[model samples]
Target: MPTPDATRFTVLDLLDLNLNEQNALNLRCIGGRKGLSREITVPDLNRPGLALSGFYESFAWQRLQIFGRGENAYLKMLAESSNVEIYDKLFSYPIPCCIFTHNLAPSKEFFDAAERGDCPILQTDLSSSEFSSRVLRVLLDIFAPQTTIHGVLVEVYGIGILLTGDSGVGKSETALELIERGHRLVADDVVDIRCVNGSVLMGQGANKVIGHHMEIRGLGIINITHLFGVGAIRDKKQIQLVCGLEEWDANKVYDRIGTEEMTTEILGVHIPKLEIPVKPGRNIPIIIETAAMNERLKKMGYHSAKEFNQNVLRWLESENARALYFNRDDFL
Candidate 1:
C-alpha cells in the first residue's frame, strides 16, 4: 500500500540505510556500479529462473531480482549451453538490480552482459532464504501505508494510546500530565502513522526536527526530553487505542457501561476507540490511565462491564424466585 513517492528509493539509498546490526545483510557492490542509481519502486522480489529458461512472458521486471543457488545453477547451465539470448532479453527491461545471495558469483558472460546493460549487481553473505526474508521485511516497512494525524501518542503502562481532538482541546496538556506520572511520550502534534504488515499501526513524530517536543498555547514550544529526561520520550510505538476528546456535551448520551465497545479504522485496521467528554472537574489524564489498564484487562479476557451485567442478572433472578415461592406459600 505504499504511495508512488515512497517507492522512489534508489539502490544507493538501500545500501546506505542504517539498518539494524542484527538484521544486516552485509550487502556490497559486486559489479555493475553504473546502475547503483537505478530506482527500486516495489517491495517485492523476483527469482529470474523462468526468464533464464527463455520464458519472459510475465516477467516481473519492476521488482528486485534475486539469484539464489537454484538460479545460479541454472545460469551456469545456460552458460554451458551457450545460450546468451536469455541474458540479453533479461537485461533489456529496466530491472532494478540483481542480488547474489550466499556469496554466489555469476558467470563471466552474465557479468559481461550486466555491465553492458548497466545493471547493478549486489552480493550478500547470507543464505538465499535468509537474505530474501530480511530484504522483504525491510522493503515492506519502507513501502507501508502511512498518514499524518494531529494527535498525541503516548505509552502508558506499556499501552499505546493515541489522543486526538480539536485544536486547543487539552490533548497536549493531558499528555504532559501522563508524562509527569511516569509515562512515555511517542509523538506530539503531527503524528506520522504507518500500517505495518497490514495489521499493526505504528506512530511516530511527523517531523524529526521537532520530535518529542510539544506546543502549549501559553508556554509556546517546550522540549519534553530536556525537561523530563530521556525516560519521558520514545521514538515510536504501536497505536493500540484511540481516545477522542471533546468539550462536555450534556445532550449526548455517553456510554456509562463498558459493554458498548467502539473502534476507529486507520488504513483498514480497526483500533479500539473511546470518546472522552472533557470538563472542568474531570481528571482527563487519570481517566486515560484507567482506560489503558482496562484495555489491557480486556485483552487478557476480563471484561468489567460484562461481569457487572452478569452479576446484576443473577441478583434479579434470585429475587424473583424468592418472591414467587413466598406468594405460593401464602396461597396455600
Candidate 2:
C-alpha cells in the first residue's frame, strides 16, 4: 500500500492541540499516532497579545503548515524570534516539519531530550531564501498532486506500460501506435495514481483535462482529444504493470522466459515491472504489446515453462516404463 502523505505540524500550531492532561506530545498525545507522546514538550512561553512572540503562539502559523495555509498571528510571531535565520527558513518552508538548522543543530542533549519528549530537528546548509525555495518546491510537489506531463497511459492487455525516457525516446510514438491497435490509453505523460486499498493502485487524469492533449518534441503541443475524440482516451485504469524504455545494452541480461516476475512498489503498492531496452532495429511498440498479452495469459492460470517441463517429465517416465516392462509385456 502506498503510504499516505505525512501528517504535518509546527511549534506555533501547538496551541489548538487541546491535548489531554497527560501533556504528552508523541504520536499518542495527538490521538493519531500511538505512543507518539513523550517525544516533545511544549514549554510555557508565558506571554500573550500581538507582540512577535505571542504570534508564534497564535493559531495562524500552526494551521497553515498542517492545512497548507498559514495564518497571520503565527507569521508575526516568527518575525519577532531572535533566531532570525531560523525564523526565515521556517516561514519559507511550505510544509510543516521540525527544523534544526545552522546554529541550532541538535546536540546529544537535544536528541536525548526529544527522545523523551522533544521535536525532531532538520539540519540544512542552504541560506534562508535558497532553502525556502527548495522546501517550497518539495511541499508544492507533494501537495499539488496535479503537476502532470501530457502523454498517453495505456494498459495493454494487463501490463501497464509507462513509456518514459529522454525526449524522442519514441514514448508517445509507441503509445500512438498501441492506441491505434485498440489498446486503452490511461493518461499521457502525467499519470495520477491513487492507492485505493492495501494492494490496489488506480491511475487516471483530471476529468476536466482528460484525453485532451499530447506533447510532441518539434510539433510542441497537440490536442489529442480534439483530433481523436473521446473513444481514443480513458479516464483511469488499475496500474498492474510497468515497462520502462532504456537505451540498448548488449551486456545486460533480459528476461528470456516468464519465470521471474519483477515488481515495482509505488506509494506502497507493488506492480509487475519490465525494462525494455530500446534499439533502432527492434520494433518496441509490438514487443510491448506482446509482453502485455503474455502477462495477461500468465494471470489466466497458464505457466508456459511449467507446462513444458511437465510434458518433458511425462515423456521420460513413459520411456523408462517401456524399458522396465519389456519382459512383463510378453509374460502377460
Question: Highest TM-score among the candidates is held by which one?
Answer: 1
Local distance difference test values of all predictions, in order: 0.90, 0.52
- RMSD, each candidate, Å? 3.1, 15.2
- lDDT by residue for model 2 (208-300), tens: 333446676777777766666677666667777777787888999987765777887767767888888899998888998987877777789
Model 2 error, position 36 (Å): 31
Off by over 4 Å in 2: 1-152, 158-160, 316-332
**Model 1, CA-based lDDT:** 0.90
TM-score on alpha carbons, each prediction: 0.87, 0.50
Off by over 4 Å in 1: 1-7, 73-86, 104-112, 327-332
Best by lDDT: 1
Candidate 2 residue-wise lDDT at 73: 37
